[model samples]
Target: MRLTMLRGPLLVAPIALLTLIPLLVVLGSFLHPQPEVWAHLSEYVLPEVINNTLILMLGVGCGVLLLGVPLAWFTAVCEFPGRRFFSWALMLPLAMPAYVLAFVQVGLLDFTGPVQTLIRDIGGDSSWFPRIRSIGGVVLVLSLAFYPYVYLLARNAFLTQGKRALEAAQMLGLSRAQGFWQVALPMARPWLIGGLTLALMETLADFGTVAIFNFDTFTTAIYKSWFSLFNLPAASQLASLLVIFVLVLVGMEHWARGARHYHSRIVAAERIQLKRWHQIAVIALCSAVLLIAFVIPVIQLLVWAKSILQEDLDSRYLGFTLRSMMISILAASLVSLLALLLVFIARRFNSRATRWMVRLATLGYAVPGSVLAVGVFLPIAWLDNLLIPIAQSMGFATFQVLKGSVAVMLLALAARFMAVAFQPMDSTMQRISRNQEDAARSLGLNQRQLLWRLHLPMLRGGMLTALLMCFVDVMKEMPITLMTRPFGWDTLAVRVFEMTSEGMWANAALPSLMIVLTGLIPVVLLVIQSENKQD
Candidate 1:
């Protein structure tokens, strides 16, 4: 018993500490002020980055609410032409990364692209269309990519309470719109805010889409500071500022949701009846959202990919594909195992410390990839410096030890995505019965035996789910992989970034399509799972 107790803290402490060091390192940058770099940043970069980031967040927040809430409400409660299909299909856009959509829209809609070119060819003016490289374009793409977060949560909230609220409102002589505004919408406030919080966090953490548009944000500033200016301290300082934004958002979410049991009865409400024109209007709205978000981007990607398939189908792509799959698999396997271990420890120990450990370990998902990349690399680079002198004394001529290696990339990825793997496993762990655990203990099963015989088998589904989620995320991840990957270790995302950066839209399409297809696996599985649960 004493040995088992010792094991929990011994195992958990190191993992939690490892998870925390990078964040601490980034936060500590303020102590070591880089005056020269800070002067240049304050003069040339900070103003625009701050202004653009704030505007981007505000725009994305409104855009998602506008797009997500109505779609969620209609699909949840109203009987429209395609309500059933739209409920799940609206989530299809989650598979399309914002950067992928950004480049696709830019490629097709830019001044010299086909859309404006055709307009010009037909003796029409081309300057009137909105530029696809502006702040508005970034907001639109990110909103389409992230609104599904709000939709998923808001729909669930409405499904549970929307119809009941409407019926109660009607009894009180309120109209349907009034019921939605005064009753149902307010009741779903927690879900709406929760979903909005997630969307905004993604917006704040975004690096790729903003980069593609050349729209300046803290994430892009961090990238340029490190890679362009070769100043790690400035990058760390910028990342710390970004971390402040994330922390504030997270704090607001917590305070807003404090002790609120908004979820009432889990009753399935009856679908609301709509007039003919209202039904038609709702159908058209939903169809337009789905069409723009998922259908058009997919078709555009297919068109570009088909054009490049003949020329781009070479050994070079095989290397890119294989490298991407290999690293994704390795990171997924590693993070899933660690996440499972943390879940097991939390369940087995059930202490305040263990809970805090779990929280710290899982906090990585809120930290952006660019921030994590800078935070993680600095410490590893410092350690490399420490070891290089020791190695030289030992007659070894080593310039770099751990810097620029796959291990650093894996570590950053594990930190950035720990929550992704932990959440599902923790939920599954919660469902496990205490009585079963006690009974097994009563039957003289040791801790190891208990885990090996019972817990592992039961957690297989969750483990696989975690693996798939992590795999897809790592495959789609850009900032960390781009910053941390060793030379000559380009993945599909890096390939897309390279091609898109150079304005080679056709070259980027194949990899973007691959990533979208990979991302769809989890979304499709989620839809199937939701259907099963509903059934």
Candidate 2:
């Protein structure tokens, strides 16, 4: 019995340890000092970094609420001309990475680009255009890219609140507008906050979008400290600060949610029908949002891709696609397996220490990828150095194993994305009945047999969902791959970044299109799942 109980932790703890090592590496840097770099950053960089980060967060928070809340309410409760289409179509933006959108927008709206050139030909000066490379631009682009997070959560919250509550408010002499303000909005506050938290975290973790705009945030600061200054310790210190910021955001979100319980007393009623002009207004609003968010960028990419297909589509392009697929598949499989192990052990043991370890293991998702890259690289480089002497003694003379390897990239991806894979599987696992386990145990089956025979079969749908989500996330991931990839091992994201940096937007379109197409897999799956639930 004792040995059986010991098995779960023995298998799970090592994976959790590996998942947590990068974060620990970041934390440990606070004790060490790169005094010159730290002094320079403190004097010149830190204040601007702090200021820009806060302003960007504030702008994006307000923008997402303004765009997401009303659209979510319209689609969830008030039926419009295209509410059915908007319900699922709005989520398409989730498949578009903020960086990709940044590239497309810059391509179309830059000074010498199509928009300004056309305006100039029509007798307007460049001053007539808004800068697409400023902080405000970053906020706008990020808001467009991230509002779907808020929209999805908020719409679902509104949909599930049930009609009874709203009817009761109306019966108390409140107008529909007043009821939305007093009852519906308040009821959905927690979900709204949750979605906002996710959007802010993504905004903070962003490196490529802000980098393209030349907007200095903590992520870019960390990158510059590492690559430009060659100061790993300074970068790690910056990363630790970023982690602190994320922790505060998480804390505030928790405090906002408090300890209130919200339960629906009745099932949701049918959506309310709108008048013709009101329906047209809703349709136009949703269409404009979707067009700006998804359709326009995608059409721009397709146009450029069409122009450059023969020049760009070749053996090397195929190699890039294949390499991306291989890495994404391998990383997704590894993360899903590790998530399953952690979730399984936590469920089986139900111990406080194990649960806390599981929580710690999932914290990597909140740490920005650029920060995580620094965290990953330092320790692996140290290990490679430590092994060199032993290899020299064994006559190999060069025994660097960890540096510039695919394995390190996969490890970083797994660490950064474990939460993505874990949440769905864990949620699904919770629905399983304890009686099934007891029934298996009564038949003399041990934990391993029970898990293999029972849990695996039941968890197939959830495990697949986890794998697909992680796969798409890894495919679209830029910062970690940019920082960690070995030379000549660029993924499509790297290709996009390289071309966009060189101002070759046409050349970037092919890979950007590939990434968006790849990302659509999960979005399509989600829409199907949502439709299934409705049916």
Name the top lDDT candidate.
1
Report the Cα lDDT for residue 183, model 1.
Answer: 96
List lDDT for all candidates, in order.
0.89, 0.87
User: Could you tell me which residue pairs clash in candidate 2?
Assistant: none
Question: Which stretches of candidate 2 lie above 4 Å from their native place?
Answer: 1-11, 264-266, 439-446
**Model 1 stretches astray by more than 4 angstroms:** 1-10, 442-444
RMSD of each: 2.0, 2.1
TM per prediction: 0.96, 0.95
- Backbone clash count for every predicted candidate, in the order shown: 0, 0
Best by TM-score: 1
Candidate 1 lDDT by residue in tens digits, 340-440: 98998898788776787789888888899998898899999989999998899999998786799999999999998898899888988888899988999
lDDT of 1 at 417: 88
